[model samples]
Target: MKLRERLEGKRMLLTGVTGFVGEALLHRILRDLPDTHVVALVRRKGSLSGRSRMEQVLNKPIFEQVRERYAGDLSALLDARVTVLEGDLSDVPALPNDLDIVIHCAGDVSFDPPINQAFQTNVLGTEQLLRRILDSGSNAHYVHVSTAYVSGRRRGAIPEGPVEHDADWRTEAHWGLAMRDRIEETSRAPGVLAKLRRAAERDHLRAGPITSAQDTERRRKEWVDKKLVEAGGERARSLGWTDVYTFTKALGERVVEEVGAPLPVTIMRPSIIESALETPFPGWIEGFKMAEPLILAYGRGELPEFPASPDSQCDVVPVDHVVNATLAAASVLPEPGTPAYFQVTSGARNPLIFARLFDLIREYFDKNPFDMGERGAVRLPIWRFPGGERVERTLVLGERAHKAADFLVTHAPRGDRVRKLARELDQQQRRLDFLRRYHDLYRAYLETELVFTDDNTWALFHGLDPEDQREFSFDITTFDWHYYLVELHCPAVTESMRKYDVIRRRRGRSAPQVAKQLPQGEGIVAAFDMDGTLLSSNVVETYLWLRMPELDGQGRAREVGALLRRMPGFLNAERKDRGRFLRAVYRRYAGADFQELERLVDDSLSQHVLERVSAAALRRVREHRAAGHRTVLITGAIRPLTRPLEPLFDEIIAADLAIDDRGRCTGFLTRPPLVGEARAAWLRRFALQNDFDLAKSYAYADSHSDLPMLRAVGRPVAVSPDVTLWREARKGRWPVEDWKTSSSVSRLTLPGANGGSSS
Candidate 1:
């Protein structure tokens, strides 16, 4: 097959020119029929950014062949044979003139698509294009790309011919259970971060267990319904098409009949098509639609449970075969009064057993032996989401996804099983929202005994020689569904996994995990703070203000806490700059503490630290330990004042005096004469005298007064930041971060300490 032969003088018009089938179709057209002119209709108003939708669509890997043919010089084709018109199908007077052929390959194919858009393009668009073709008077052949699922209302053995019956479109629920817990997401909307966060959370959730069988089934159903709402299905009614995509596709067939009564039209319908194997190329797939779930769920060990019967037949086709059928239909068929119908499908005479498909995929994965790194392959149970009478067995299965998830989890340390469970719950909620918003069509796609017949197609296939059959036959009988599925399923899922970069699987060696191990070496000084930043007290707690009146010096202690809690809300607003700033600070300094000091802060001092432990302040102690850095807790508050928070740090250097063994107050300062320049001054001198590395030591505080103390360290991190340190950071561009930036955490511990205790 070469391009210079057929297209040497012919001209063609192609819509959906950048789509999966369209791209493949164009490549085949160019190769088999060279010198042909191709006119690609692209939207002028593209990404709503600046990139042309054509460029965006062509960037996908599926369009590689087409892109290569054009050699990035689509303009040459545009100026010569390929002209990219900046117009939409819905726009009228679609054709400038008439052509030899009009290949309309554009239309929504989502099984669970929206109600309205389904008909707008599938029906109305097709009719509009037909009218233009008729008006051209160029005696052009019109070929439409329709899905096999267009048999929306039909069941059992489907024929291999164009269906002309008026279809009853489904506008309401498939199962008729009103959904109540709808989460409004803006991913499909204008904003990006809102969409990103939602996407992140959804990814986070799916990483967990499905909980119970009932829950899994319910989610699956919801997922299907969710997909229906995404495409313009609900919006297409105004466009005069039926409400459902499948029904509308059937309707589109009739629309062709009405307007294109005399024009040459071919309705090419293909069954569930997978990747190619022999012809053209082997294993080239675009997405994970159709049978992706069966393979992936099974691969992850989550799909031992079946939704449909094992005995059912799942007809599938190869992309190359579909391409061949499409090309052959276009090149060979002569223009007739009624359109030539070709069903490129599978089943009955050309069926592959669904049970065999599932069985082989499972067998291959088990025997193929590929290491997915440290976590190993996804742990599968004999059954998924088991419970009640089999609760104990379920427990073991669940445990495997948790504790055995050792290599699976990353970034965050493996903890109690409850942690994994909590993460799972949070993630599912987000996924539910995402499914409802962005993937409505995916959610609404119906699952039935959906099978197609291709008697006419088989005849066409058999008419050709055995070699021709290999080249042009789309006969489903020849397909090895197992090979097709694994080849098709792996790339999409793998691409998605790569895009998400989920290192936190229940297995695998995580990126440089630094656990907050108990501190070993001794520290010289421990500095701490009270109020929300330290003891987790109410921002306006008067006792805190009274002790650190300097915080009131600018009304900042409360100000900083207020800023941190409002972080997430600000990320989506015009004030994102402020949010970015706060986020940075929280990361570098929020948990800046000495690990060695944590036990002391917890045991000896925490109980008497004037109040309960502040998880925020305790975090600082853990960080220093995690870094193997020595620490000294310094504060203006009394020793008993920070007692509860004491074990979290090394030594307490407080304003309060310590009692000797004689139970007498020693007026001598535990801290050296370290104040103002004397603070950085004496601290540096004392550290050196005591063999403490001034370059390695760190100092933490909650006030502008601590600037000198901060400068004494190699790294200066400001927690929940203040106006003073915030300015210094900019001048120096010091490292900043917000601790909460990593993962959405459980409830933040509300502050409890009063009278301000600093560690």
Candidate 2:
């Protein structure tokens, strides 16, 4: 049963030879029937018209295997006997002469198809191809790919044969297509004539005319819908098809059944086909227009609370099975006058219930966890199920948010959003500039997902005899859905991510000369936000920072002691997450002097930031100096408390310090202590005046409050970030790192002044 023996040197023409099903079939045809010349439909070489579509299908891994299997270039075989007619399917199907088999798999597959396109390809285009077979004067097998749902109104127990047509109901969807064509034609016609007529009116607002062509093909829209109802919902239920795709597919079936004569023909009805488990290479699929959304929702962890009866049937099959079945059907094609029908499905006969499918998914996830990016391998506590009503409530809340924003814009923060967006845009531009300046060392984060189905496909080849099935047994009954869903899907993501990483790393290596090293010298103080940027730790409630002084008027409840004193009630209150309690416990009203704070900082250094950094980050600090960058620590931890960090850098800048009469503390800052705008602007001015280039600087920070400092620097990275910081970083396209273990000193801290600290 060699391929050369099967085709007997005859030529085969295929319309969607580059498509998912077609590509696999093309491979099968060429592999099993080597002597069979493949006349694949390819667009003109230099045409920009369908490049995206063409490249996506033709450049598949299967096609590569086809070329390799032939032991030479596919182009050579094509040039010799496999003719590639370059033309659009919508145009008349001008096919090659003298073909043995004509497998048509091209055209629209989406349920909600844009109009004019459905008939052009699915119905009329198919009709044109069949005519091409007749016109070429060659007896070819018309292997038309029709949907299983073309059964129209047939309910249960679909027979494995052509739907018996009643004498009265012969012409099915042709009437609708004719009606729709006119509507489509009128919709595209010149509305300018009407506009011109209006302009020529006796007494109108005569400033020429105002028109941009919007004419409703109302009669057409209504006609098609009525026709869909008449034609039945087989197309709807089977393919989840809308009026456009279903009626047209129904039309395709009727047209072929009526007109496909004087030639051998077989219509294949493929149900929901999914990823290949064992046949060919695993997980081979093209654009997932149908199954993609579900996959995307799953990947995003949004499908955890979906609406589906656990007991509902979920039939799926691998694509290779369909290819095998199609081939077998082709091999045993009945002579002209007799048409064969193969319902390649895994419906109730071999049910794969929703519960079983979900269990498989859960099992897959349990064994092979999906990468959560920066979130780490998460056994994320399942979010509380918010029903459909809750989702509506969220939508309502969204409206409320919009209203609040509108009110705020009208009242206080007038144009604040505009200003904020502009500032953000400017910052993003600077980051891009930096990345481009050092192209080799920078990268843009690129992400993509994989989705597919294969049920009728597995049964496609299974329709053949036992020996044939053995050779091409692509059934899914024995498929390990869990392993496939987990392993098959995750690899695609991981491999794509790995490739993306490689591309980005290569890009990052192209970083500008200045990006390689920070500016050196003692005078060049590159001040950085301690929490996220320079040092890694939460400035707010990090376990270490929580031990800092209370800073109440007395200052007696110092550091850990103060925390311990308030911990019992605050812990209870904090669990409720109220604003007032948090504010009272966190914000320092009466502050400490620079000197006294420094003393406390040095004394309690180990309890504060010092114990946080790992050995690796400490090494990075040394590397920073060796690279000639003058590092300085900057924080919002009140005054002299920041002084303990001085020894690790050239200088330290904290919230301004003030002292009263004789070495006692002052409640308020000495000057209008820099924060937000004042902080970043001051740093920028200092860098400019001190010959330090903001364009060549780098800063890191943890909290959202320190975002200004991070954004001001050329390279602003985040470490152990808060939600706000993480989102802003993404929007701003900033780098992020989280070295928060004992092995890495990324967030190092020095001892505090005395036995207390203010972090």
Candidate 3:
């Protein structure tokens, strides 16, 4: 009989209903095999109950076509045709006695899961389920879902058959016991515990005080969990598996073969599963999968290089095809002695070369660019798919260059070009780090040159009548790679990424909204230093240099010559007291109209400083504003220099020059300049006069002279500090930021000399 006819009115148990392939199978069964009753196993996520989780999964866009089919009667259909089983696989005691089919799809898919976790869930879990089936005496046709990567690092054509016992092979139970023993040994090792303790303490020191015992205990647990995951990755590589997920999955298949010896069993191994091609609905994917990250990163121009063989096949199959092949395998009941196997992959039929896939990806992202707001649109990066060894060598050289650039930026003469070069190198380093991570995680898989044989899958397809063949279509020979990737896969992946970005941005913190009423003296204050903290360079010096050419035509030639002659004296005064030098520097504008100088400062600020505003400082100002704090710009420079930033601040405080009745500038200060201790004293007086809480205020500065003011505030931040101030900030453990450059320039890079071509 046909599969659907036999499936009608049969009791089938399905695991992993919330996963990608499982959801597709569930939808297919409900829509086509209408009479099949499905008992689905679902795990509770946090506060969500099993039934609630199932409802959420069904409501996902992947099941949208099924929902449309049933219309308002969807709930009625699900309630009648589906049964929810709550709890994990290992917790279950026995299978339903009336179960005619058992499709085990639930397994951990984490690439770097804990060693014990992968084995327990994938291998032992399968053994438990099979034992339960045997104990209950249910004559169920079991279908175990596995991955094509279980072929491991093998080359040449992999056959669709049983995983035979070789010289190194052991029984599944023994293998599980050995892995469990290793996990226990690693967990309780003295060196491991000591490492965890030291790492936790370092993390706490980097953050703040870890006062509570519960907090320390939590950190210890987190460290242990991280260690376990690392160990799992190591073990997988040593065992010739691509990852912990695939390694344990291979063992799971072995378990099924061993335990289901007398039962009718079939194992289906599918390749890299993408969205559904023809069934359920097109362009339906649940979340970001293996290849989507590389795709999105390349689209955003983040990942420019990767290590992969250009000639190798990608071996991708749609979820619907995998599901169809799975059902087909289950229908063909195996003999009592031997189990059947099917490789549900497209590599052998419709092979897609890596070069072709890369071209399609580039074409798709080129036509539709990812928007990145003010920074500009994201341009797609060039794909450098040289051999793995060549890519590794290039990355090493790139890392060395990043380090050299870092040292040069620190020690070279300080200027815009220097800072820009530093920023560029830092960005390159971050990209390199990302590439390195990708290489480490996926190197084995990407380097694989094997093609899986889907002989059994095709055999099952041809065995079905033409009508059944069309109904349950697992035939991948007719699949089109370019159309599927460009029209369906890429667009679907991009839409999912954009939707996620929208949700994240909405939930993220935003800039402070403008309040209708201006803040008063009673509110909290966030004082910011004006010069290097906000502007990229010193405003006083830059403004003076900018006005030098204009001063050539004025009657100030003699005075300018006199000032230049006394430059050494001015420099000496600056060494003794910065306040005095600042006070005397205003004499350059002595005879000029005060209003004209103000206009000059304003014009110069608009032309030079506005675009050079530090992004980090702007973000912090917005954060403080969002928190309802009054932002104040505090500087020793005159008010005209800081007036352009007034809109971003609640108040501006600066040194004032004595003006004559005719608005002409006098070459003297009205009061002592606000510098060093004077600035701290002013803050104290301002807080007292306004009835503000000193302990709740914040201050940001870049110079060591502003140490007094920083120490007076409750939260002190050091922004783009000089050498002395950076040292002091480190001593006090103050939060320091490089506001002169973008955050992209601050990303971590592997150590190397900056002497190579740009990546």
* Candidate no. 1 TM-score: 0.55
Stretches of candidate 1 above 4 Å error?
1-8, 45-74, 77-81, 162-243, 334-336, 368-374, 381-421, 428-451, 462-470, 486-534, 539-759
TM-score per prediction, in order, is 0.55, 0.51, 0.65
Candidate 2 lDDT, 447-560, residue by residue in tens:
001111233344445555567667776554555556666677445434454466557666662212224444565444455665444444433344334233423435534655
Candidate with best lDDT: 3
**Two-way TM-score contest, 2 vs 3, winner:** 3
The TM-score ranking, best first, is 3, 1, 2
Q: Best TM-score goes to which candidate?
A: 3
Better of 1 and 2 by lDDT: 2
Across 278-316, the per-residue lDDT of candidate 1 in tens digits comes to 544566666665666555545655443443345556667
lDDT of each: 0.52, 0.54, 0.74
Q: Which stretches of candidate 3 lie over 4 Å from their true place?
A: 68-75, 165-227, 371-379, 399-430, 498-759
Instruction: List the candidate 2 regions with Cα displacement exceeding 4 Å.
Output: 1-4, 45-60, 65-74, 152-154, 164-243, 377-467, 476-480, 483-759
| Candidate 3, lDDT over the whole model | 0.74
The positional error of residue 237 in candidate 1, measured at the CA in angstroms, is: 16
What TM-score would candidate 2 get against the native?
0.51
Better of 1 and 3 by lDDT: 3
**In model 1, how large is the Cα lDDT of residue 461?**
68
Per residue, candidate 3 scores C-alpha lDDT tens digits across 536-626 of 6553454453345344445236645677797878765554566767776876657667687676656544434455578767877877787
